[model samples]
Target chain A: MIGYLDFVIALALAGAMAVMLTRLCLGPSLYDRILAVNSFGTKTVLFLSVFAIMVGRADGVDIALLYALINFIATIAILKFFRYRSLDVALSQMTKRIDQVEGGQ
Target chain B: MANLDLTQYLDYALIAMLVVVGIAIIRMKNLFAIVMLTGTYSLLSAAWFVSLDAVDVAFTEAAVGAGISTVLMLGAMLLTARDCKPEGKARHIVALLVVVITGAALLYALGDMPIYGDPNSPVNAYVGMDYVAMTPNDINVPNIVTAVLASYRGFDTLGETFVVFTAGLGVALLLGLGGRKEEEN
Candidate 1:
């Protein structure tokens, strides 16, 4: 049955999450931790989608979509902040580059 | 074992994971690793919320907890030390005692709550039933959580939106990201 399949999927996802949790907790380097967190976010999105189907709520997909977008943006923001030490600096540099390109065009 | 359902097993597993992650976060010395574990904790808790059929709460947790909060914490960490300073043993003991007492109090309080997802629970008996029944006719939305959040509780949702906006504005102002100034020569 469909319910059984959903249960199996949920179990598998939970197992993967457990592995990611170990990596997150035991990371010797910052980038390793970041990669683990990123992978966990992707797994969470899939888990949410499976759960929505299991619960017979098609609209749960909306939440999953929101998570997908926010997760991507957050990862980028974190990486930029880590590299530049200031989001403001990153933003201004990006804008200045864009303006230069536009002016050249 | 025969009576236990899939959801029950899943809930137990997720709760166990959450507890382990919480402990790891507390014991971590590296601030960056702690932040990463916190994000994982949030994701696990969000999954637990979904299992409880609280999609709206799960959505908010996923977005705010795992998403925005992680990024903000990383930014803050970048601005500060990557490793946490060692604390005195006395301080550690005091903190542990405080945590234990607070956790014990919370566990005691949990005894007064109704069983999860019980149809006969007071919350489900009153406003929840009405929302479920009226949502189709009142809002015509397929998702009751959406209808309740956006329509039935429009003013509350608006307030939440404004709170988020204000937080963003505060961060932007604090970071001086508003207007571009010439780099110091």
Candidate 2:
């Protein structure tokens, strides 16, 4: 039945999450850890969807969509911060370029 | 077989994994791995909340705990050293004792709590039921959580949104991303 499928999918997601946890705990490099966290976020989104089906609350899908968007933004922010040292520096540099373009125009 | 359901089994498994992950996080010395594990922990907790049928709470936890906090912590880690300094044995022991006592007190308090998902619990019998019953008539929204959060609790949500805005503004100011840039030039 549909309920059995939901249970199976949830169990599979949980198992995958367990593996990601181990990778996170034992990751040798920072990149590995970052990758693990990103993968875990993906799994969580899928898990939330499966859980919505299990509970018969289709509205829970909205939360899953929110999670997906937030997770993408967070990962991008973390990477940008890591590369630029300070987010302010990045923002300032962009604004300086914009001002130069305006002056040229 | 008679006592256990699929959801209960899933809950127990997830909790067991969470405890292991928590211990691993504490034992690890690498700051990056710790941050990553913290995200995993948050996701697990959010999943657990979903299992408990607290969709709104789960949503908040997933967004804030797993998403925003992880990015913030990563930003902090970038500004700090990657490795944690070893603590004194005495400090460690004191911290451990404090944690144990607090955890024990919390467990003791749990005895007075209503059983999980009990229909007759005061929470379910009162305001929770009122919200569920009236939500359909008053709000006409499919998702009661959204209706309550956006309409019934509009002011509180507004305050929360402002709090997030203020925090972002503070971060921008601290990082010199605000009007200070013009002053510097």
Q: Please report how far candidate 1 places residue B70 from its true position, in Å.
A: 1.6
lDDT of 2 by residue, A36-93 (tens): 8789889888988887888777866887897787677667665555555444553545
Clashing pairs in 2: none
The residue ranges of model 1 lying beyond 4 angstroms of the native Cα positions read A91-105, B1-4, B136-140, B166-181
By summed lDDT, the worst window of 10 consecutive residues in model 1 chain A runs over: A96-105
- What range of 10 consecutive residues in model 1 chain B has the weakest lDDT sum? B170-179
- lDDT, candidate 2, B89-183, per-residue tens: 99989998999999999999999999967999998898888889999999999877788899999999887677567545534533454333453
Report the number of backbone clashes for model 2: 0
TM-score to true structure, per model: 0.83, 0.81
Indicate the DockQ of the complex predicted as candidate 2: 0.34
Q: Write the per-residue lDDT of candidate 1 for residues B49-133, one digit (tens) a residue.
A: 8778777777667767877687678768857887888878999899989999999999999999999668899999999999999
How high is the CA lDDT of each candidate model? 0.75, 0.75
Q: Give the best candidate by DockQ.
A: 1
